[model samples]
Target: MSNWNGNWESFARDAELAAKERLNEVDRISESNQWKVIKAFQKHRVSDFHFNSSTGYGYNDRGREVLDEVYAEVFGAESAIVRPHFVSGTHTIGIALFGVLRPGDEIVFVTGKPYDTLHKVLGHPGDGTGSLADWGVGFTFVPLLGNGQVDWEGVKAAVTPRTKVFAIQRSRGYDWRPSFTIQDIEEMVGKLRSIKDDAVIFADNCYGEFTEEREPTEIGVDLIAGSLIKNPGGGIAASGGYIAGRRDLVELAAYRLTAPGIGGEVGAMLGTTRSIYQGLYLAPLLVGQAVKGSVFAASAFERLGFETHPTWNDPRTDLIQAIRFRSAEHLITFVQAVQRAAAVDSHVVPEPWDMPGYENPVIMAAGTFIQGGSLELSADAPIREPYIAFMQGGLTYAHVKLAVRQVIEDMHSRNLL
Candidate 1:
């Protein structure tokens, strides 16, 4: 009753079998992270009353207050701000940067250029878009070494007395490089502290939460931000973002989120409190499932002689799995195959377009229940050379396996495999 040829079927079987040990490792991490989240919930004494929504000024919203406390405890940060008001991960990160840096201050990225969206946020000098550069905040980045490691010498040379913040991006974003591990961040923190103890060390934690036992905050990161729809959402949080780190830094970000006088004291949960709480409870296990899916994807593609970052057995610090393709057509077909396997919108095919905030057109295969939630099964790529598709997230390992099979079968049908 199967349509696959013997060779393709054998490839699928071999890929799964090869990923057994890595999958087991992912499960262990899930167990540990799940317990950590449970303990945070217990420490906060979370109750049904805390899920109640608030309206108007939301002056005394206990649910909102407790959510912040729970996130802070979970991330091992001095304080946190969790709110539905943040439109996206980029917005949350923008708030953190703007809140901390004054007009004359500068932010130096230690992990090479950040994801494409942030380029606009960084803006150009006097672009007049109210972006950082337009507002007089300086921005620059130290390119990573050829091996994808941080360029410490470049970082040292880039730093100035005006460098108020040093940023580290935990995920690879659209790049074909290895995501930074907690240990790597710890080392970077040490190096940066030695160079400039007063500078604030910030982390862009999107697509990276719950993937490891400890977060960047635990390793001395001064601030961190991420979207709820990514790993922390558990594929359930409808919309929101969170910022966690030092108490003063979090408060400053909160001020930017609302108003300076109000700060975190007033955000209405708007009936999303319950789902957000439950989502945090489920995040660890769901993230583990996604990571397992990424491992399987890596193995499957590597077996086909396609290059993969953080190969199946390589240590995974995030859910993203990048697979290189031979041509633009091959990349487009692969992404379309991912869309075909989507449970929500299999009938809707995706195409490359001039999506905002990037230099080139991008194709995305979401078809997720939560619009742009990457924590659900999705694939995307910018239409560029040495074409690569970045795939991430699956609510269950089974869904990912099915999608991978469909992608292979589709490619074969088109004589692409």
Candidate 2:
């Protein structure tokens, strides 16, 4: 609760009170909708791929249908498609770009520096296998400013008659910093529309979903893309990607979706109906709880002299939080402790190895029961300096407290404490 930038104790008190106030506001705002949907959500069985649904179904395009309802609730935008086949966030983006642009058209990446994988996708390796550059489509970047936000003037400079799309990525990373605010998106859209009404305005809606009450879909973005496996997957969705956008673009995406696995253009539902649905249902309350856990972890770590990224005093935050240790061994140790913190009756050790397509190695303490990232199960990934000592998943505050304690205990056991 304390704000290290100023008076600490007073800030802590005020921050706590404000947080409680916000919680009250959220409850009041979501009262009817939250109760009806989330309570019922508890009734839905946890979805499983091995036993319950199609073995290789595409992410539920039907999921897109649900996003459609969200769109109507938010923007007046026309259609949506959610597919489980987008193996990673990268694939989902590829599908959206391929679906929207003509072979000879162009797209401008509005993000200053997007996800690491995206640089390649935007034609970085002009001749590499499956590189998007082979398509003859042109791409450009809207350089970001020092604070890690889009440079509006640079964007205008990047625009061209050939530019068929403008896209922004929102997700977890250490490359610049957080840039896309609700206001930034709105302003970007205004600029795009003024430049060219037909130029598609797209956003990579990843870990950022449920971060705020109002989403880009609600703010008039032409298309919003994201991964279910990360957020709405709710530790349930086996795998999937979703695109909610202009009706025609969505329809075209369905066609490209054919090669992936959704049954040739009608779209792959990826048997995610129950899981994605369930994840979405539990997301709001779960996300709120995650922010709380993050606040605790961030504050505690910051107080211990490690650099941290979040504060309980801030408005609301996404589930992810980072604590930089500045050393690979320390990073691994931190991840191990965090995982131990989550296990109630058992412990799991994390392994660090080189990830495919990753120039640098990535480490993860994956203790998931379902063979995927499970918030319900505790885990952490520390990639070295700026290592994020991150953790999420505790059904209640008590559960999170236990996890936090155990993690700290592990650190003490090793004398890292």
Candidate 3:
């Protein structure tokens, strides 16, 4: 590791030193969120018995029930559903949307277009995949202004009597923009409420979990959803997703997760209860580590003259650290270097391909214990102009630091840095 050539080693060290203040702030947020999780656990009386698995109809699954309570408490929501049954973040968000929306109801995206993976779920009319559009739940987005702020006038123009839900994506996703902070979401909730008091405000709380002192639900978000394997998983949860918010909205999502009469009551834990519980317990600190990694990456990349969103000292509301590259080759090199630094699957090389649920070919470097676990160090990018790679997650800050050094060395060797 000491073999780093040129200014790479110094760049890494200087980046860490430069980000000290911001890293401390991240720690404070983590500490607060940690206490919040512990309080929730204490309030719910989590126990070893709750870790035991259930089978068949899974009636009287105390573990599952308590897990829900703990999540609801942590997120400051009236109710929650934590289930491995929901496959991915996109799936979880889809369930939440489908739960409360009806034919003729419309969804207005006040935060601009959501992540690319959700496009298919939104679907085009009559596409026949049974998407929301196919079900007659119309959807449209009011693009953000040039400054990446919400287009309030555009949102007001878009809302109609049919606008039943207003969606907000808490993360930057693939966009080269700032991730919305809790305060930002609160302001948006206020603005949206003034326009349509009855419309449900939904937040896609994907990579944003535990990154702030308060969650979107704590402000005014009527519903929020996220994947356990991302932030809340703490690199321990094998698989799962969660939906939390108003009691009625949560119940509606639960109905969509299972059946109407058997909402959140009948799903078998299948022995995943323990990790899920422990994952949530560790999520706050783990999320802090990931956020620190993001900051370090931003600082280090900025020193190397690359463009980074949410620069080193900028406020962090999510784990993603997007670095724009000069070309697709540079982006690919950066992603491949991240894979090389992985403890798992270090020998495998990543290449862009037509990944499902994305319009563009994509490349990903995910060498995680759990497949697609972004909580572990990983980087991915869609092959498009303004080539950018979105790097997120690190179970340990040390690993993230090492990955940055490795990326710098590898890219420099190829003359791409």
Q: TM-score for model 1?
A: 0.98
Judge candidate 2 at residue 380 and give its lDDT.
54
Q: How do the residues 123-183 of candidate 1 rate in per-residue lDDT, one tens digit apiece?
A: 9888989899998999889999999999999999999989999999999999988999999
**Ten contiguous residues minimizing lDDT sum, candidate 1:** 1-10
Candidate 2: stretches off by over 4 Å: 1-76, 125-128, 259-272, 342-346, 374-400, 413-417
1-417: candidate 3 lDDT, tens digit per residue: 222348655667777899999999999999999999999999988888999999998999999999999999999999999998888999999999999999899999999999999999999889999999999999989999999999999999999999999999999989999999999999999999999999999999999999999999999899999998999989999899999999999999999989898798799988899999999999999999999999998988888888899899999999999998899988999999899999999999999999988889999999899999989999999999989999999999999998888888788788775
Give per-residue lDDT, candidate 1, residue 174: 91
Q: Candidates' TM-scores? A: 0.98, 0.78, 0.98
| Backbone steric clashes in candidate 1, count | 0
TM-score of 2: 0.78
lDDT of each: 0.92, 0.60, 0.93
lDDT per residue, candidate 2, 1-417, as tens digits?
213333434534443454565545434533443454454334432223322343344344333444445433433346666666677777887888888887678788878656666666666434755556667788887777777666878888888878888887754454425435566677778877887788888888766655565667667788877776665566667787677777777777767767444323344454556666666666656555555665655555555467765444444434556566656666787666656655443566667778765556666555554444534535455365555555544434445545555555555566564
Candidate 1 — what's its lDDT? 0.92
